[model samples]
Structure formats: structure tokens, C-alpha cells
Target: MTYLFNQPSAFAAELIEGFVAANADKVRQVRGGVVRSTRSKAGTVAIVVGGGSGHYPAFAGLVGQGLAHGAAMGNLFASPSAQQIYNVAVAANNGGGVLLGFGNYAGDVLHFGQACERLRADGIPCELLPVTDDISSASVSEIEKRRGVAGDLAVFKVASAAAEAGHNLAEVFRLAQHANQRTRSFGVAFSGCTLPGATHPLFEVEKGHMALGMGIHGEPGIKDTLVPRADVLAEIFVDNLLSELPAGVAAAKGQRVAAILNGLGSVKYEELFVVYRRVAQLLASAGVTVVEPEVGEFVTSFNMAGASLTLMWLDDTLETLWHAPANAPAYRKGSVIVAEALSPAEREEPVQETLPEASAVSQQSAQRVLLLLEAMAQQIQSSAEELGRIDAVAGDGDHGIGMERGVLGAVAKAREVAARGAGAGTLLCRAADAWADQAGGTSGALWGVALTAIGTALGDQQEPDASRVATGVRHAREGIMHFGKAQPGDKTMVDVLVPFSDHLSQAVAQGASLSDAWQQAATVAHDAAQATAQLLPKMGRARPLAEKSLGTPDAGAISLALIVNTVGSLLHDKTPV
Candidate 1:
């Protein structure tokens, strides 16, 4: 359990500050994360890796020469915001393009994908290669759906090595993808990890029993059984991983592999070495050669009592990359030639966005937006716990907290900007930035994009007519779909958004009043959210535990319905045109 913390929310930031101070020779503090203090060769493809902060060496620890150029560190067990990812990548980028790599998780996918889009729009070349190495999350046929775990090391190392070797962006991306395809990992936990300031773990294991197929996020394991002896546990780990070999590998015999016996957090090195003892014997018996075996904490959950074994099937290229010299703060390989330290530069002031002038009529509508934001915030606060419970059925149970954080931030920013006489578009754009920054998750990014799209449609210079409002809704729906990659039947907020936008557009085109159109759209969204209970989730973190969510509405969809209905109440009471 994590016992050391001043404020739970501030833990990640504080930790990063300390880490940078302790490793000033190797890394420098950036706005979003840490970047290499040592200079890189000009025009080298920068490899940026990141994820939630709880996993130590998996992310920030790997930032240095011949490893990751930078890392976008997020709050405990939560993915970083898109702005954070973009900032880190910007700081790390030399003249060459950037290759972003991380675990295959929902929040990471959304944020990294958004950063890639923004980077490309700004003419900075970027690509993403999400590592999918945990075999238990999905079947072999559905490997892309699997979650990444300890095997992150294998993929990141290969990609960083390729980049350091002067490989182009395309070649580095290909090597990262190939490494991910050839890696497989399996794990078990004696107990779950406790997040900072939390009294209990995310999930519990029965006493005297062990949970199998555990992840690095403190998520409960897929299966549970009696705790085995050290040798027996090693046997279980090896068997599960060997059950599914990488494609083109006919058998374990005569195959060379890189083996990592990793402690989750609380598991000590002595315990891991005991397990590895049996692991080595079994591998030798199977005629599989283990090369450069690593036995210690590499990737870890916060005080989680568990361990995992990763096997990366190696070819000649992989072997060369795997053995390449690295000089990170935490992990070091063969000796590396140090480059000159980065030149000291004065910090630049952040550029402020200029707000366009607004018409008096649009300014009045902006006040109405402030009211809407207040109502939405109140509704989210009241429903947060229920939303979390629903999400916990098949996902990490943070949706309620995340939504409440985002809505409250949006309301606060809207209130501040409205007080400054900002127009609807300006207020919403500021609020969008605040929401995404505070929430820091998949939902946060999608919500921020949706709100920004709506704000764009409602220009500051004109009055917001019914047609324009409908257009804004349609724009928001499209933005969410494009950024989140979620369709209506995926049982996400998109299910509610699609119907709501369609109904609003149809009603407004049929000459309905703004209030009337909104009422009809809210009804459609509410119904769509309820219908999600009957549909299986086909995306996001819930996809792995799809069956468990059979009778529960998606937390995101339900929250969308709640906010829309709350807004409907305010619209009903307003003066009708």
C-alpha cells in the first residue's frame, strides 16, 4: 500500500520534481515530463515513451541516452493529457521525426493519438506504436486488444536503439511494431496495489490465493486460485507465456529469447531470483536459450505484491538492439559515450490566445453557457459515484471522479472567462483546455475535443441561431468520433452523442425552437444511454471484461445522458422564442 503522500492528487507532480532534481545529469524537467539532459545527434528520430506514473522504470526511468528521449508522466494509474504528450514530444524532438510508444491502454491510445494528429497538423512528423504484450487480455486472434505490461521494455528498447542507430522514422516505427508482435507476458498477484491516499487496493485477492493474468495498473487478475510454491508459481508463469508463441516461431526448442522476471512492486528481488531459479531450469529443459536475462523490478505497480515474466522472441536484429548500450538514470547497460550536455536556454513565456470580439447578442448567449456549465457540474458531482461503480464493472473505476473533475474545471474556466466579457467561443475554448488538463484521461480528451468543436461552430461575432446550435452539436459529435475512434454500437458516449446530434439536427431543420430541439435531442440521448446496457462494449478498457458489463450502462454514455437531461431542464424554464 502507498502510505507516503502529502496530497494524493499532487503526488505525481511532486515525484517528478524530485526525480529531476535527483537525476539532473541524465534528465531535465520539462512542462509535461522529463527529457534527456544529454544532447542527441542532430536529426535522430526521437523515441518518446510514457504512461501513468505508478510504473517506475517502465516510463520515466527509461529517459536518457540510448533509451527514451522523453516521457509524458501522468497521475497515478491515469494516462497523461494530450497537451502533456505534445509538450514532452516537442521538447524531445530534434530535427528528425518522433516515434511515440507506450502500453496499449484506452487513455494512452486516445491522448497519444490526439497528440499525433496535432503534431502532424503543425508539420512535425510523428507516429505511434502501442505495445500489446499481455497475452491474457485477449485471444491470439485478437492480439491488438491485449494490454501491455512488463514487456514494454522490449518494445521501447528496440525502438530507441533503432532510432539511435540513425534509422528513419518509418524504420524505427516498423522495428517497434515488430518487437511488440514478438513479445508475450503473463503475471500473477498475491494482492492488489493501493493508490495513494486510498484505504484499499483497486481490487482484492482472496487470502492464501493468487490472482493470475494481473496487469500493472492494480487491476484485479483474470483468474484466482491457491497460492503456489515458488517453483510452482514459476512453472505457472512460464506455462501461460509459452502457451502462445509469436508468429513464425514453430516451437520453444532451439529458439533464443530475452527473459525478464519482473517484480511488480512489493515483491522483493530475493523472491524474484528464487522464482527465476526454477524458470531457468525449465527453459533449459525445453531447449530454449535465455539471453541477457533480467531479474528485478523493471515495470511496477505501486506496492502491488506480484510479478510477471516477459519473453521476447529474438531475431538477429532484435538481439543486436536488445544488447545496445544504454545510460538511463535507473537502468544502465554496457558503457556508452556521453554526448555534450544540452545548452542552457532562457525559459520562454507561454503564448496567450487572443479572443475575437463578440456581438452583444452572442455575449448574452455566453452567459447562458455559464449557466449550463453550472448545471452540468452539479449533475456530475451528484452522479460521480454511481458512474464509477458502473465503470468498475468492466473498467478502472475512475470515470465518476474524472467526469466530475473535468466538468468542475470547465465550469470554473467558463465563469472566469465570462466575467472577463469573453464571448461564447472564447469561454468554451478556455474551458476545453481546463477540462482536458484537469481530467487527464480518455474521457477528458474526448470531452475537451467535443466542447472545442461546439465552441468553434458558435463564432463570437454572431448570434447563435437554432441552425448554428444544431451545427455545433453535429460538429461536436464528429470530433468525438474522430478523436476517440468510438462508434455508436461500441457502447461508449458516442452511442448517446450520435443520436442526440442527429435528433437535434433533424428537429432544427424542421423549424423547431432551440428549446424544443434540445428537449427532443436529450430524450434521444437518454434512450441511447439506456440501450447501452443491452449492448456489449466493443472498445476501451471494458473490451477485455466485456461480459461483466452486460447489464450495466457505460459510465461515459450514462454521464452524457445525465448532463443533457440537466441542460434540458434549464432550457424548459428559459423564455421561448
Candidate 2:
């Protein structure tokens, strides 16, 4: 699909242009995208840097009061050259020297190395600091080659403090290097991303899968798998990150870190915390001290569906810099915590109201069906985080967690239903009821209605068939609309589900197996979800945000299409291995 979002060519220029225009009082652009402050003190070690674009506040966005002295801007996913780096360093070097810090990439090293040598020739003291924090993207043997992700901020902050304290360029450079050596990070992506002028995505996984350790420039990652829950993925990302650090090498060591949970883009704050809850616990268990954990978009790849965890072993100096007074457009060190309060007894962060246990079931056929359903439920349960990332595009972005909770609830209900010798329809309906009751959101209500309608249509007597399955979905759509009051044009999941069920019913009535009919249904749903981007959404929370959502398919509709597609795929293929 064509991206409605800003093209890097157009986007980068606009962003840098606006930043310079508004921050005029705080900074002055030197030759190349390198900007300098007119007020920077003479003989004060200067912090000069740049990287690929889209990670504002890292190389450019933070070039203001009490922060960096100069920033060399680059194009999207493209680093600035030696010329650009030289321009910034020459301007920023006022005898106290200049410390250059940037993400580690081959191009950056080549260019920054050239710039450093050039500055040295000019009698300007210069040292280079490259960030290597995303352990997810590299092997220990190849850590030096791994591209820096969100660790830019932590490492840079250390250098900035040294510079502000009037340390010679050498000392400042050493501190920045120290931060880079100790910091580590990891990321997970629900979907791939694209550059401004690109057509196809830079990387792609199955609709329901995630790419673990996906890098900044839409780089492919080490692992790809279905991820349905934010918390589960959070646990995985956190564990991987913790395992890489020296502090996590042993418990009771109590290593301290200032952590960052960064939203690449489009992933909202409301949804990000679900991941953070698990991450915090993982770090605590590893005996890593989290001095202050930040949760927001500090580094982004233009609405890419992912989050990265950055951990820095906070030495006393780094801790002071982290807590140092600072202000920038997207970040402020004094940023207030938006987290809700928790009493001692009220244990869970979100108070994860655990679902009831599955009931025992007897009938062999019923049990087999449940076994298959359980697989689908397990798949959903395992995919919560990725779902949230995809859903953030259009709907409320809670579909991942909501869908996961609903599936688990359905699993529990399925066991109880099967135990009572309930018909296929009856079991499905009971599961639907539990899903709706436990999962509090739109997806829950829609799936719940679908299951309930299917059960009623069956009336406790008939075996499920292609035609009846389609009929049940149709009835479910009707029920969903009645309660949700959402129309097909409203850019909701109904947009995809209604047409999907209709095609299923028509195809089945025309003679098709359950598998074939479902496959067709999923296909139509996929197309429909994509088509919702073209329609005007007139209802839901999306209506207000609809303008920004143009050209982006509804995440809820995408989820429906994905879940249905997976179910059909499961029915057609060998059972889950």
C-alpha cells in the first residue's frame, strides 16, 4: 500500500527545516546539517554528532540548552559524510576540543574517521565515540559492527555532561566511550517499515509474526515468529537484553541501569507500558538496578511497529548526567512519570486479573476440536505484543492484549463446554461469552458476538459446516454492529468482518469445504482491511485521529484478517507442531 506518511526525502527536510526555524534562538546551522549554538562557551569541550535520520533528539533534536553544542544532520537512514562531520566539529571546537559521538555503522566510521583526522590536522583535538548497544542485532564477536539504536541518548548524555563540565576533549571522549561499552539494547518488531521513496517494505514477516532485533533502517533481524502479547514479548526482549550485560551475569550483584523503552513510531504510550511492566520485573530479577526507566518515543523509524529496550550500567557520573537538568523537544530529563499509583497489596502493575483454569472435558471428538482450538488460542496468547504494535496504526492499539486475553478466556471456557457434552456451536458460544466478559474492548465484543451467534445458529444439535460457520459469522457481525454501533465505513473491524462472512456464506452455499470457505473468507477480509484505508471512518476513537490515519489500514481489521487467516491456514495444513 502507498504510504500516507512523510517521505524521507520530503520528511527529513521538513523536520530539519522546522527544527532550525523554531530553535533559531537556541541554535545556528553551520555548513552541512550541523547546527551550533551562538551561546556555546569558548574552550568548553563540545559534543558534536550525527546519524541516519528519523531518530530526532538523538543527533539533531537535542542540540539546545544544557545539551549538545552541535549536531550534524543526515538523510533518512543515511549518515552524514566527512564534510558534514568536519563542518560541525570545526565550528564546535573552541580550544577545549570536540568529542564526536554517533551510532556505529561502517559509513559513519569511515566518514567520522576522516573528519577526526581532518580536525586533528587543523590543530583541533578530536576523539570519536561510537555507540554499540543493540545486542539483539549482533553477536558478541560482531558487537562492534552492530548498529546503534536508542542507546544514542544515554551515551551522548554522558559526553554532554563532560563537555559542560569543561573536561578536555580527551576526557569527554573517554566518558562517552565508557557509556557505549557498558550500554546494551534489544528490539522487537510486529511489522516491517519503509523509507520515504520506497514502495515495498524493507523487510517483511508473516502478518501475525514479529522480527526480533530488527534494526533502525528496516534491517532484517535474527528471529521471526508469531507474537500476540506485549507482556510475553516484553519478557523475551528484556531477558535477552539482561543476559547480554555483565551485571546480569550474576544475581545479588545489584547492577544499576537507567533504562529506556523506546517507541519507534505509531506505537502509542498507552500500549507501550504493557511491555514495560514485564521488562521492569525481568530487570529486577536479574539484580539490575533501574535508576530511572523512560517510556516514550525517543528514537523512531517513522511509524514502524516496534519497541527497543536500552540499558545503561549507571555509574555515579552517568547517573548524575542522566538526572542532570535538561530539556529538548521530544525528551526532558525532568519528565514527570505518568504511571498510575499502586498500593503495596495491589500487586500487579495492570492488576492482571488472571483468568480461571480450564475445565476437564470427556468426549473424544469434543476434546480433539478443543485441542485444535487450544492451539489457535495458544498462538494468540503468545502474540500479544506484536498485535498491540500492529493495532496502534488505526484502532485503540489494545487489540493485541485484548485478543490475547479473549483467547485465553475462550480456552478456559472451551474446556468447560466440552466437559458438559455441549455441541460444537454450544462450546463456541460459551467460549465467546467468556471472551467477551473477560476481554474488555472492541475485538473482544466482536469475537464474542461471533462465537455466540454461531452457537445460537447451531441450536445445540448440528455439527459445524461450511454453510453454518458462514451463517454464524454473519449473525455475529449483526450482533457486533448492534452493540458496537460501528458501520463498515467507520474504519472498524466490521469493515473487514462483514464482507468476509458474506463471502464465506455465499461460497459455502455454492458448495465448498469448511477449509476452502474459510480461506476465501480470510482473503476477502485481508483485502477489505486494506480497503478500509480508502474509506472515511465515521465512528470510534479513530474518527478524530482519522486525518493522520489516512493511507494506513485499520489495525483492528488487520488483526481480524490475520486471526481468521491463521485459523484457516491451521485447518488446511498439518496441525501445530
Candidate 3:
């Protein structure tokens, strides 16, 4: 369990703060995460790798010379927001473009992909390298669906080495792709890890038993079996990875591989060495050569009693890149010539947005929007624990906390903009940006999209009518679907959002009042959310544990329903048109 934390919600932020302070010479703090304090060579592709916060050394620790240019850290087990990724990329960008690398999880894909598009739109060349190395997550036929695990280290190292060698963006991306293709990892957990301030761990394994193929984000393993001897466990890891050799590697024999025996969190180095001893014997017996094999924690889940093994089959180019010099906070390969530190002037600052002019009617509407945001914040704060419980059934169990952080940030931003006499549209847009920035996850990005869509539909110059509001809601639905790629039956928030938007639009078109229409739609949303309990998840982290989520409604769907119902009640009370 996490013993040192002031507040659970503030843990991720505080940890980043302390990490930057400790490694000030190596890395500097940025808006989202950390960037190399030293300047990079001109025209080198910036390698930005990231994921959730608990995996120390993986994200922030890897930001230094000859490694990642920066890392966009997220909430406990959540993906960083698009705004966060964009900010880091902008800070890290040199003359060359950016290469964003992360685990191939649903949230990471959604957030990082959005950031890539935004960077491209801004005329920055950007590419994505999602590491898919965990063989347990998906079958070989569906290799693209596999989740990234400790194997992220191999991909990050190779890509960053290529970038440091002054390779252009395209070449860096190609090398990273090659690294990802050659990597494979498998893990087992004796026990689960607890989040800060949580009374219980995310999941548990029975005593004397170990969970096979567990994830770094506190996800339970796919299967359970009695704990085996260290040599036997080593055999299991070697056997699984050898069973599926990457394309181009016709056989494990005569193949040179970079082997990493990673301790998830609490597993000691002594224990890992014992396992690696046998691991070495197995590889040697199989005629596979081990090169620079790492035997310690590289990517960890906060204090999880688990370990994983990764084997990256190395060709000539990969082997040379794998042996390249690297200097980071936690990872150091060899001697590197220290570069000059970035000057204070080179560091970027937050740009304050200028408020647009607003009419009196629109300004008054902003006040009503502020009230709605406040109510949503309160509702989320009250229901966060329950929402997290539901999500923990199959997901990472951070939904409630994520929503609380998002809604609170939105309310705060709305209040700030409304006090400046901003219009409803401007206020909502500002709030949307804040929600995405503060929350930093899939739901955060989706909610930000939804709010921005509504705000765009209702321009700042005019007061919104019932039809205009319905149109805005419909646009929100469309935007979420476009960005999230989840259909109604995917067991996501779309299940509730689509029905609510359809019903509200239909009612408004039939000349119903805004309040009445919203009330009716809220009922439909509530029913839709409840129906999610019977549907299996086809997206997100829950997909791997679909059966476990059979009796629980999606946390995203539930939160959307609750927020819309809260808004419906406010509308019914005649708070505003």
C-alpha cells in the first residue's frame, strides 16, 4: 500500500514535483511532465514517451540525454490528456518533428492519437509508436490488440537512440516500429498494488498462488495458478515468449536478444537475480544468445509484488542501437558527453488566453452554465468512490477520481471565465480545456471534446434557444463518437450519450420546451446506463476482462447519466433557458 500521500487526487502531481526537484540537473519540469534539461542536437527527432504515473523510471525517469526528450505523465493509471501531450511536444520539439511512444492501451491510443493530429495541424511533423509486446493480452493473429508491458523499455531505448543519432523523424519512427515488432513480454503477480489512500488493492491473488499475465496498471492477471519455483517461473516466461517469435525471427536458436527481467515494484533485485540465473541457462540451452540482459525494475506498478521478462530479438542494427549510450535519472547505459543546460529564457511559460467580447444576454447565460458546472462537480465528488468501484470490476479503477478531478477543474475554469464577463460559449470552451488538462485520461479527453462541441455550436454572440441547445448536444455526441470510436453497444459512454442526444433532438424538433425535453432525455440516459450492466465491453482496458464486467455498468456511462440528470433537474427548476 502507498504510505506517503497528502491526498489521493494530488498524488500524481506531487510525485512529479518531487521527481523534478530531485533530478533538476538531468530534467526540468514541464506543464505535463518533464523534459531533458540539456539541449539536443538540431534536427534530431524528439522522442517523447509516456503513460500512467505509477510506472517509475519508465516515463519521467527516462527523460534525459540519449533517451526521451520528454514524457507526458498522467494520473495514477490514466493516460495523459491531449493538451498535456501537445504541451510536452511543443516544449521538446527541435527543428525535427516529434515521435510519440506509449503503451498500446485504449486510453493512451485515444489521447496520444489526438495529440498527434493537433501537432500535425499546427505544422509540426508528428508520428505515433504504440508498443504492443504483451503476448498474453491477445492472440498472435490479433497481435495489434496486445497491450504493452515492460517491453516498452526496449522500444523506447531503440527509438531514442536512433533520434540521438540525428536520424530524421521518419527514420526514427521506422526504427521504433521495428523495435516494437521484435519485442515480447510476459509477467506474473503474487499480489496486487494499492493506489494512494485506497483501503484495498486493485485486485488480489490467493495466498500461495500467482496471477499470470498481469498488467502494469493494476489489472488482474488472465489466469491463476499455484506459485512455482524460481526456475520453473523462468521456464514459463522463456517458453511463452519463444512460442511466438516475431516475424523475421524464424527460430529462437542462434538469435541474439536483449533480455530484461523486470521487477514490477516490490520484488527485490536478489529475487530477480535468482530468476534470471535460470533464465540465462534456458536461453543458452536453446542456443539463443543474451545481450546486455537487464535484471531490475525498469517499468513498475507502484509496489506491485510482480515481475516480468522481456526479450527483444536483435538484428545487427537493433543490437548496435541497444548498446548505445544513455544517461537518465534511473537508466544509465554508458558514458555520455554532457550537453549545456537550457537557459531560463528557453523554458516555455503558460500563455494566458485573451477573452472575447460578449453581449449581456450571453454573459448572463454564462452564469447559468457556471451553476451547472458547479452542480456536476458536487455530484461527481459524491459519487466518485462508487464509480471507481464499478470501474475496478474490470477496468483500472480510476474513473471516479478522474471524473472528480475533471469536473472540479471545469467548474473552476467556468467560474474564472464567467467572472471575466465571458459568454457561455467562451466559458464552456475554457472549462473544456481545463478539464482535459487536469484530468488527463480517455474520459477527460472525451468530455473535453463534448464540451467544446457544445460551446462551438452556441456562439458567444447569441443566447442559446432549445433548438440550438439540442443541436449542440447532437454535435457533442458526434464529436465523441468521432474521437473515441466507440459505438452504442461498445459499453462506453456512447451507449448513454447517443440515446440522450437522439431523444433530446427529436423532442426539440417536435416543439417541446428545453427543460421538458432534457428531463425526458435524462430518463433515457439513466436507463441506457443501467442497460450497460448486461452488455460486455468491447473497448478500453475492460475488454481483456469482459466477463468480469458482466454485472457492472460502465463507469463512463454512469457518470454521463448522472451529470445529465443533474443538469435536467437544474433546467426543470427554471434556472435558465
Off by over 4 Å in 2: 1-10, 247-253, 334-577
lDDT digits (tens) for residues 1-577 of candidate 1? 6768899878998999999899988998887788898889889999999988889987899999989999998777778878788899988998799999989887888889988988999988999998899987778888887888999998999999999999999999998999999999998888887888888788777899888887777554578899989999999988888889899899999999999999989999999999999999999898899999999988998788889999999999999999999999878888899878876762232465466788787778899888988888999999999999999999989999999988998999899888778888878877887788678788988888888888888878777778887888899898888878888799999999999999999999999988999999999999999999998989877876899999999999999999888988898899321
Instruction: Tell me which of candidates 2 and 3 scores higher on lDDT.
Output: 3
Worst 10 residues of 3 by lDDT: 213-222
> Can you write out model 2's per-residue Cα lDDT over 409-513, one digit (the tens) per residue?
788988986766665656776787566544534455567667778766755444455666677788888876775667878888889988998888888888887
| Winner by lDDT between candidate 3 and candidate 1 | 3
Best by TM-score: 3
Order of candidate numbers by TM-score, starting with the best: 3, 1, 2
lDDT of 3: 0.91
- In order, candidate lDDTs are 0.87, 0.70, 0.91
Compute the lDDT of residue 31 as modeled in candidate 1: 71
Ranking 2 against 3 by TM-score, winner: 3
Tell me the tens digit of each residue's lDDT in model 3 across 1-577: 8888998878999999999899988898888888988889988899999988999978999999989999999888778888789889988998799999999887788789888998999999999999999998888899998889999999999999999998899999999999999999999999888999989887777889999997776565679999999999999999998999999999888999999999999999999999999999999999999999999999998888989999999999999999999999999998899889888877656677689999899999999989999999999999999999999888878899889989999999899989889999989988987898777778998998889889877778899899889999999999889888999899999999999999999999999999999999999999999999999999887887899999899999999999999999999999874
RMSD of each: 2.4, 25.0, 1.8
